[model samples]
Target chain A: MTSVFLLQWQRFRRAPLMVLSFLALTIVFVMVMAGSNPGNSMTVPTYAHPALAEQQQDEWLEQLNKSEGLQFELVEEQEARQAVLDGDTGMALQLMEDDYRLLIVADDPNRFEVESYINRTYAEELRIRQLEQQSTSGEARERVAEMLEEPALTVETQSLEGEQESFVYDGQLQMLFGMALFFSIYTIMFSLMKIVEEKKFGTWNRLILSPLDKWQVYMGHLLYSFTIGYVQIVLVLVLFKYLFNFDVGDQFGLLLLITAVYTFSIVALSMLVMGLVQSPQQLQAVVPIVATGMAMIGGAFWPIELVTNNMLLAISKVLPITYGLDALKSVAIHGRGLTELMEPIAVMLLIGVVCMGIGINLMERKR
Target chain B: MLETEELTKVFKSKAAVDGVSLYLDKGESVGLLGPNGAGKSTTISMISTLSKPTTGDVRLDGRSVVKDPGKMRKVLGVVPQEIALYEDLSAYENLQFFGRIYGLSGSRLEQAIQQALELVGLKERQKEIVKTYSGGMQRRINIAAAMMHEPELIIMDEPTVGIDPQSRSHILEMVRQLNKEKGLTVLYTSHYMEEVERLCDRVYIMDHGTIIASGTKDELKSILSGEETIWIELDRPYPELFAELAAHPEIVQAAETEKGIKLIIPKGKRILGSIFQSAERHQAQILNVNVQTPTLEDVFLHLTGRKLRD
Candidate 1:
């Protein structure tokens, strides 16, 4: 076992380009996620003499001492603008006049209530001032206040259909999972093809005819491929977490479990390819075509949602990558608990076992 | 002792190795001499457990290899016709890998590798990758790799093919040394008759997937004793000389060329003097005269009606 591990390590060491690709992919992921969102951008300062402007506005409002009519508060321009837009505040008062007269800047285009309030208050104030010149009458003041108090219309905001945010994040997580699955499968298949090439070149025969049993040679190759696939998955996941801001949510344990399952399935599929194909070139040309196509249709490169029909979806559901992606998406993006993802996880595990059984059977048959 | 009993291998409809039986005593060097496609390599492959014989059984010390190849594999070393060393790996590394596969490890493995390399006279250059070595050097290392496990029986399938004469001789010498000094039984296969004649204690000449002749050099030579081979060189020989040589009572076979006439006489010593006297009468000056014993090649030609190379 130690020798097998050492041999595998040697194979990995020899394939530095693959490792470098994984690292580069992580960087690309980080770059894409970091640069895509604009909401995270810093705010630009647009205020000039903000404190002085607020003080002047407040002092001017104080001078218009008929405070019973209406009043405005000095606030940050952005905050004030937002409140007006949201219909939280009636209107903003930047300046006011004092001759039983008043001025208001109507931020809302349909400021009907605020306008009425201003009009009635001004009228009442004029009447009070005139009455003060002669005789102050409480009945006249009450009449003016009564005229100002117009009935207000109540409005309720609601939508007929409930809003459900589309599972876009789930889709993205599926894509990442799909990519990881595809890469892992591709790596294992490629490694197997490399071994076939070695065989064709007589390198394998040299090793086999040497005092080694079939198992040692097989295990050495298996370890090399397994390590490659495992590393590819790790790199893709790390990239998802950091670069894509991919919330592989919180299920680290579930993610690891899914990853292990996917790795085994891919490795077993590779062994099947190796067992069936005699020539290295044949293995190389055929494996990626079949594996990549399966992954694509199974929703690795694109979301399964794009295939709207029930039949295609049903077919995708049966694919190993589909189950793998589903489990990953459930764990990573939806933050689904383990129980929620058990079905897909179980399917993935089953696929791994079935593939392994078939792969070993095929190998034994060849022998 | 290694024995193959009625061993046969069929590839599709054609028999690659027909019912063939042969044996090599322990510590004895036996050679399989045949032309290309003579099933020499196939026979070696089956005997070494690298390939399965379609029918028949191979036994090492009376233990059936067919029933339990693993047991046979344990005691067998194979040096294939093609150089089987890993081109990318150093000679020592290749040896180490094979040694480990044969269940040699630790200091024992190291000692075995060293001994094998020394036996092949390649210990000094063992650190170099096999690809970096000359063709002959690679061949030597190829054989050395097989020897690493120090198996009781060594099977070499045309180990000297395509090698230079010096390297070929060196490999042959190494094989002889291994057999003589270490008492390692060897089943050597080659097309070169001289190689077998030099190194093999016994020779089996095969053709068309069947062994046609098998014996010691002298024994095989004795097979052609009824016919004496006579070689005569002349400045110029007439076509009629062929007829004249064929007419001799003792001459069993005759072939004439522009420069000479070769006659196979049943009793050469009695008839050679008469043939020379007859040649003198025909005004044929004998530039050279020689009477020789039959070699393995002659035995092969006599039995198969074709030269070994043909």
Candidate 2:
């Protein structure tokens, strides 16, 4: 087993381009896509309407800039319009006395985020102004703000299971985890392709004729694939977390554990695919399809929360990537501990064992 | 030291190897000669314990290995027909891994790799990746990988199927040394007649999954001892003259070869004069003529009515 495992590493060293390319791709994709929305924040250019006073626009800007996830910059109306027209920004916010309008230009994925932020800020500031108008004294808005800060009646929303219901979306960590897991599929499946090549070329028979057991031979290849995939995910996560300063929360250890389980599950899934295919060329065609399809259905390209179809959500429950992404987000975004992540970890492990058992059985039966 | 008893393998109701029984003594190089799809590779697979025979047993040292292949596998080294080494790795790396697979380690594994490389005449190029090597060099590394463990018996399945003559000769010489000097029991299979004729001490000629003949090279050639082969080299194919020669009572069998018509005639026959007369009458040009003693090729043609490489 050691010999076979070590052999794969030696072979990988000689032809490390495929695996390294995947690692580089994961980094590059995350750096470009997730890096564009660091800290889930975007800078929106704000300009006051010609009828609005400068003092009122400054107050609106102050309220809008209070949001940690959005930066509202005050600029001249002409300059803001020019920026939007020139495609320097996706959209610009025009401040009015009682309302605001978004001057749209090019389409942006983060456009909704900017709109939601401005809408909430405008509503709150307008309500406060209305409250100030109805008061005999002019301190009514300040008193309302103080009361809102510490509400007399607080509503704590929870699921029927008594768990807190809150959705925290960090675009950076989502891209980091999604692309890391997605590209690791390519790395794992392609590495496992060595088994199909060995069988096709008859090197497998040489190992069989040796003193080593058949399980040892399989374990050698499986272990190598698992290690490569695990390392790629961990390395990408660490690089983004430290180098790029992407927030993965404080549960680095849990993320590592999740990564290990996810890597194992993917390795086993790759083995099952290997058993179903006849040749390496067939595997080469199938790997990308499986990876891309799983990424699409399991929410590697987007958060599972965004997928509304019940059928797709049901299918995602069976896919290991669903659990992988869910568990990773739970740790990185929700700050969940290992105890809360037991469900996903257990599901991933179960999937790994079942797929590995079926895969090895199918392969051995073919033999 | 090893034998298979009535080894039969069936695939989807078609018997690939039907009741093939052959044996190898200690330090003997045996050849299994057959055309493609004659079930030679299948038989080797069963004996090497890489596959299970449908209805037979393979025994090593008087123990049935059909149920327990570990005993047979322990002493077996198989050089498959395909180039089986990892192409991306160097020859040294492939040999080192094969050695470790057989439980060799430390200095022993290194020594075994160097020894195998030297035996295959590839020691100087051991550090180069196998994919960068020529087909012949890749094949040499293929054999060297199998030799890494220094097994008691080595089974080679067409190790020189497609290679340059020089590399083929090199492999043949290496196998000869391994058998003669190292006393490694060898079971070599090929469709090429000369390779088997020159290397094997005993030859088994198979056709359609059955062993048609098995004896020493000289003993097998004696099957055609009463006949001699006439090589009539012509300028081109003369179908009419070939038909005339084939119809003659003195010629037992006349087949068109690449060169010209080859006639199997009874010994001490004086049919050359008549052959020339027929050729002249047909306006055929005879480039050359030579009569030679029978070889394994003739024996195979006599038994199966087909060439060894057909």
Candidate 3:
């Protein structure tokens, strides 16, 4: 067993691509999917209406551009509304009956920002006009200006000690975790691919011919698979924590433990795949199907709540990742502890044992 | 120190290795001679404990290892016919791994790896990955991997199946060095007659999953004592006339060839006159003819009435 483990380690080091693919691809996933969208900046379009006074239009244009949080352009009236409906832009501002109205679709991430900006800008313009008409004296105008400057109601935000529902599109944590789980499939396939290479290279016969116990051979590979998957998950997690300053909540230790177990189960499951398939081509065909299907059902790609089918959701409950996500979400987001979440850890371990047992057992029988 | 008694294996209704008994004394080189599918590998497999015998037992140092194959594995270094190595790993890494599993440790394991690499003349390039190696280099490393433990007996199964002649000679020389200079025992198997003739003191000829003959090379060849072989390359096929020559009293054996036939005749016999007469009658012109002393190939022919390659 020691020999097998050492050999596998040496082999892994020699094939730098194998190690780098996991880290490199995961980093890309982090950058593309989990990148911080610090507060949004958007641009919208409207039309140059012929009926509006030129000076008022210029004043409104200057204010809207400065405060839209994003840049906008002037298009024809129909084109402006159509762009919003066609999903070209999230929202658009239109001038109507001595006021302004914002056009939007049913779903948009920038709905609140657009609506508030439009209302505040138009209300301030109307207030200034009303005050100027009533007070012509300089002293009265100064008093009215001071009164209008004060806010009607002050709103301050304070977060309580509880799970916070996500109101922003910061997918960094979810993307990071999803990629880590998805890569366990690669670890599994590569692990089995090494076995196939052994058979082709004829080293498998030497192993069989050796006096070493069969478990040592299987266990060595099993451990290597775990190590590879575990290392990749850790690297990605650490990046998210230190580089992005992303919140992994307080239970870092418990989160690490569950992830390690999750990786073990995934590696063992891959070993099962290796035991069943005889060639690299078979591995390529089978692994993608199995891993993608599992990730999809396990909520690694998108949240399971996004899935509307009851039958599909019910099936996903049996998958190992559902428990992994549940356990991970509890510890990383909800601040749960090991004692409070015993069942998921136990279930992950159970899956690992069953998978590793059957996989190694089949290989031993083959020998 | 190894022996098999009536060992057998049955795959479904067919027997791959039938009842056969063979033995190897200490510090002796023995050859298992047979064509393909003659159960040489199957017998080796059972002896190596990679497969179990259906009946009988393999005894190591006068002890049966049917139920458990332990003690013998410690003292035996096996070189499978296949390369049997990790190509992605460097040669040194491969040797170290094999040596460690064989129970060597620390500096002792290091020494064994170095010695094995040097034995195969691959120490200088040991750091390079095996995938970068030529076929012969890989074969040498394969042999080196087996020798890491310095086992009492080294069992090689057709170690030179498809290799350039230069590497083939190098491997043969390495085996000779291990067996003769080091006093290591060897159990070598091959289909090539010349390899066995040049290497082993004793030989076993196998056919149809059983040993037909086993003796010293000279002793086995003595089965067709005072025999001379005739090579007849004809212009065309001569089945009818060849049949006549086969039925003659002096012709010991006759096997057909693509162009003509090969005849094994008794020594000091004047059978060429009758052969030429038969060929003339068949209207087949003899392109070439040569007579030589009996070889292991001829002995195989005399015993089975078929070519060794057949």
Candidate 4:
């Protein structure tokens, strides 16, 4: 087993392009998609309607700018319209006294976030004005503001994983985790494809006819795939955490544990794929399809919270990457502990075992 | 030291090798001769413990290796038909890995690598990557990898299939030295009649998943010794005369050659006079005629009625 494992490392040293290219792609994709200030805020150009006075428009701008997740910038109506038309910004907001209009020229994923922010701000400001109109003391607005500082009643939002704050999406960590795990699929599956190549080229028969046990050979190959995948993901995560200043939470050890389980699950999943394939060319076509499909359907490209289709959510339940992304986000965003993470971890291990058993059985049956 | 008794392997109810029984003594080099799809590879795969026999026994030194292949694997080395070495790795590294798998380590492993490389005549180029080498060089390294542990029995399956003559000769000579000098028992399989004739002390002619004949080379060739093959060359097509000769009483077997016709007749026959008369009646011009003693090729042709390559 050691001999076979060591030989794989030597081969990897001779041609490290496939693995390295995946790692580099992960870095490039995250940097490009997430942009400079991920999760901090999204900037949306805003302009007041001409019927509104300058003073009222300034008040609306101040109220809209109070949101922590969406930054509203005041601009001339013509400039905001031109910004959307020229494709500079994906959307622009035109504010009215009682309502607002969104001039969207292109589809933007962050459009939901900006709209949610403006809706809540407008409702609160309008209600305060209404309260002030009905009050005889004429200090209803001030009292409402003071009362909001210390609310009489609050509803605590928690998840199944014990006590937790409301969900706060960290785009930097999301991109970092999502891309790292997604690209690691390619690294792991392509590395495991060596087993198929060896069988095709007949080197597998050489090892089988040798004195080594059959299980030893399999263990060697599987261990190599696991290690390479684990390293790529960890390295990518570390680089993003330290070099790019992405906040991946302070539970570093828990993060490593999650990566290990995810890597194992992926390795076993790759094994199942290998067993289904007949040749290396078939596997080459399969790896990308499996990787990209799993990423898209399993919520690696976007958060599962945003995916609402019942059938897709049902399919995501069976995929290891779904649990992997969930566990990772729970760790980074929700700050959940190990006990809370048991569900995802156990699900991942179950997938690993089931897939590995079926995979090896199918492969041996073919032989 | 090794034998298989009625060994059979069936895939999806089709027998790849059926009722094959052959044996090899220690230090003897035997050949398995057959065309493609003759189950030569399947037979060797079963014998080498790479595949399980569906309903037979492969015994190594009186112990059924089918039950326990560990001992057999420890003493057997297989050189597969394909170039099986890791192309991305250097030849030296490939040998080192194979050696280690067979329990060689430290100085012993290093010595085994050196000896295997030396045996294949690639010691000087051992450090080069296998993918960078020519096809012949890669083939040599393939043989070297199987030789890493110096097993007592080496099963080589068409080791010289697609190599240059120089490399083929080098491989044949190396096999001879290994068998004669090192006393390494060999079960070499090939479709090329000359390779088997040159390297094997005994030969087994197989076709359609069964061994038709097995014996020493002389013993196999003697199957056709009762008659001699006559090659009669004509200037052009003489279908009528060739048909007449084929219908002749004493012509045991007649086949049309590229030039004219080939006939197998009694060794002491003097039917050249009748052949000439028939040719003259047809006005067919004779180019040349030659009579030759029976070779393994003739013996195979006489038995199977097909060319060795066909």
Best-matching candidate per DockQ: 2
User: What is the C-alpha local distance difference test score of each model?
Assistant: 0.72, 0.90, 0.80, 0.90
lDDT of 1 by residue, A1-367 (tens): 4454464454456456765665465445434533442111211111223334556444444433344323444455666556645655545433333222222234443355445654565555556757656765547656655765873554655555555224443434554566667766766777666566655655555565555667777777777777777877887787668765756677777788888777777777677767787677777688768787878778876677577888778877657788887777766655778787788878877776777677767765654
Ranking by TM-score: 2, 4, 3, 1
lDDT of 3 by residue, A263-358 (tens): 887887777777787677888899889888988988887777678899989888667787887777767766778997899888878887888788
Task: Go through the candidates in order and give each one's DockQ.
Answer: 0.25, 0.84, 0.51, 0.76
Docking class of 4: medium
Question: By the TM-score metric, which is better: model 2 or model 4?
Answer: 2
Candidate 1 positional error at A200, Å: 3.4
lDDT (Cα, 0-100) at B193 in candidate 3: 91
Q: Which 10 consecutive positions of candidate 1 chain B have the poorest summed lDDT?
A: B250-259
- Score residue A6 of candidate 4 by CA lDDT: 91
TM-score (chain B) of candidate 1: 0.84
Worst 10 residues of 1 chain A by lDDT: A38-47
- Deviation from native of the Cα of residue B173 in model 3, angstroms: 2.6
Candidate 4: give the clashing pairs: none
Candidate 4 deviant stretches above 4 angstroms: A45-66, A72-85, A90-150, A155-171, B232-248, B255-262, B272-288
What are the TM-scores, per candidate, against the unseen true structure?
0.70, 0.92, 0.80, 0.87
Error of 3 at A169 (Å): 8.7
For model 2, residues A1-367, the per-residue Cα lDDT tens digits are 8888888988888789999999999999999988675655778898888899989988888888898888889888899999999988899999998899999977888888788878887888888788888888999977887898999999977778566556677878888989999999999999999999999988998888888889999999999999999999999998988997888999899999999999999999999999999899999999999999999999999888888999999999989999999999989888889999999999999999999999988888777
Query: What TM-score does each prediction get for chain A alone?
Result: 0.59, 0.86, 0.68, 0.78
Q: Write the per-residue lDDT of candidate 2 for residues B66-160, one digit (tens) a residue.
A: 89999888888888999998887888888888888888889998899888888888889889988999988999999888878778999999999
lDDT (C-alpha) at residue A17 in model 4 = 92
- In terms of docking quality, model 2 is high
Q: Which of the CAPRI classes, incorrect, acceptable, medium or high, describes model 1? A: acceptable
